[model samples]
Target: MKTRAVRMYGEMDLRLEEFELPEIKDDEILVKVISDSICMSTYKLAKQGKKHKRAPQDIDVNPIITGHECSGVIVQVGEKWKDKYKVGDKWALQPALNYQGKLDSPGYSYRFCGGDATYCIMPHEVMELDALLPYDGEAFYQASLGEPMSCVIGGYHANYHTNKQNYNHAMGTKKDGNILIMGGCGPMGLGAVSYGIRFENKPKRIVVTDVDDAKLERAASVISPEFAASKGVELIYFNSSKENAEEELLALTDGHGYDDVFVYVPFKPVAEMGDRLLAFDGCMNFFAGPTDNQFKSEINLYNAHYTSTHILGTTGGNNDDLLEALQLAAKGEINPSVMVTHVGGLDAVADTTCNLPGIPGGKKLCYTQFDMPLTAIDDFEELGKKDELFAKLDESCKAHNGLWNPEAEKILFAHFNVEI
Candidate 1:
């Protein structure tokens, strides 16, 4: 089969080319990728190439495909796994294969098996580790977003509280306790905020801090304070760039501090601020990853020993977290669409991945079968003046409170005469 994908040749060297894929083995499956959400980790991989720990060293010779967070329909099922999986089944990728204790993963180490392609092969190890998840969501984009949402869910699950009577640790955030999410307004941070308010063990209050007022306002417009209040949780947004930011943030909790604090930015000050805001026995999760190898932050050791404050970090989600995210999204309990602000085609993947940080907005979702530039949903109206397709899409999104939805995706595909 012939597949077109973005392949990384070296550091910042990605090419969008067409190649013939070898016939799938009996133990492997073939899929037609529909949607893929760009991730920061993929940007890091493009920057580091062979130097990335999870990336193969021989990318210069045999280039590897460049994407991971993806979802699609199964086109062909291998005979070895026909009983467990069949053609036309929708699947989301977990990507953390953890196969045989190696750093290798789908997007970074595979040649014919990655998300940024019209078609790709799913190796046997993907099913062996249960990394290829079955998805029944209404939209393919939601399934693609499940991977990032799982990371947010994993951060919450990784937090622990201690029992004074015993040495064991109680998993998960403190139920009905005060929670703080620092630097919360980006894509992943927004997912964390949504999960914080909607999770079964909802927090008493959630305080989100960010430097940008526009972003904070946009976040509130979607996941409003009223919405959180309906769920028996108080939601507040604070600007963290002020001179008295720390003092003002602490006052929001009535001086009791936060029981669960999440740092969504890798800046040292943000990490240190999260440390100071921890209540007695409070758990802090450093959710954002830093690109620098020598990144460091100061922690109050006295508080750690005397106040029972501690911190931990998580990079990816496990099978359980992925399943939870998918179920919640499918049930309409959580809206992963809030994280997607832009959409494009496979032709836009390389440029979008390379300049992801420079671009403003949340997730950039790519549809694999067409050729379109990366376009923001917020700009639909302006683009609509020139094209009627975008006009219909803009009207559809505006009807749904300006957020991307299944109807908008259908309109986009229908305009192109695509059957998806």
Candidate 2:
């Protein structure tokens, strides 16, 4: 079989080409990709290309497809995996290959096994780790959102609540305590907010901070303070660029510092601001990763010793977190759709991924089976009149308040002329 894939040939080079895939080995599984969500990390790797730590060593010999957050249906399962999986099974990917701590993963370094394609091969490491997981959900975003949602949960799990007095006090976010989400207007931030309010051990107050008021407003409409209040959680949106940003945040926390601060942007000043937002024994999660190796930020060590404030950072997520994300989503406890503001198809992903940083949305969901360009539902009203295909999508999303659901996905996929 031949798969059409967008491959990274070198720095600033990505090509969509058709290639004959090798026969599936006895231990391999072949699957057709469905929905995928573009991540900022993919943009980071795209710009850095061969220079990226997890990127292929030599693009000439090892060009790979990009993107890790995805879900798909198993079209053919290898004989070895047949007992555990079937041809019609659905799955999500953990996407982290901690193989002896080597930098190898599907989207970043595996050419034929990545998610940004019509189809792919599952490598030995993926099978060994059981990352291709069986799932039960209606929206493909459940599978696509699993990796990122796991990351949000993993960040919480990775934190440490300090009991030791002198050298260090605590780690992780305080359970049922005040929390701050820095740059919380983006896709990942929305997930963090959803998880924060809906978590069993919910916080007293969850503060979401951003520089853009419009984004803050839009976010408010999605995960409204009214909605959060129903769950006995206070959700507030603050524009950090304002003069009273810190004071306002502290005020929401009842004059005490935030017990947990999650920094969603990688800029030094934001990190610096996040450091200041930490309270005594507060744990800071630097969620957004910077590309530069020499990037440095000013941290308050005196406060670290005096107030026991410390910080922790992590990449991707582990397997268990994926399952937890799926379970929570299945129960309707958390809405992953809030993170997605745009939806398109495989043809749009290449361009959308390249210009992700500039694209103004939370998550850009892509359906691989269709041939549509990157299009945002917000613009549907303007474009719908010009095109009937978009007219249907706009109508569907309007009913859900600009959110994409299984129905919207089905409507959009049905517009495709050919069967996939």
> Which candidate has the highest TM-score of all?
1
For each candidate in the order shown, give its overall lDDT on alpha carbons.
0.92, 0.84
Q: Note the clash tally of each candidate.
A: 0, 7
Error of 2 at 301 (Å): 0.9
* 1-420 per-residue lDDT for model 1 (tens digits): 899999999999999999999999999999999989999999999998888888888999999998999999999988998999989999999997788898788889999999999999999999888888899888889999999999999999999999689999989899999999998999999999899988766899999999999999999998999999998999999999999998988898899999999999899999999999999999999999888888999999999999999999989999899999999998989889889899999999999999998999999999998889999999999999999988998999999888999998888788776554
Predict model 2's lDDT versus the native: 0.84
Candidate 2 positional error at 137, Å: 0.7
- Clashes by residue pair, model 2: 159-172, 160-171, 160-172, 161-171, 162-169, 162-170, 162-171
Score every model by TM-score: 0.99, 0.96
The count of backbone overlaps in candidate 1 is 0
| RMSD values, in order shown | 0.9, 1.9
Q: Please name the candidate that would achieve the greatest lDDT relative to the true structure.
A: 1
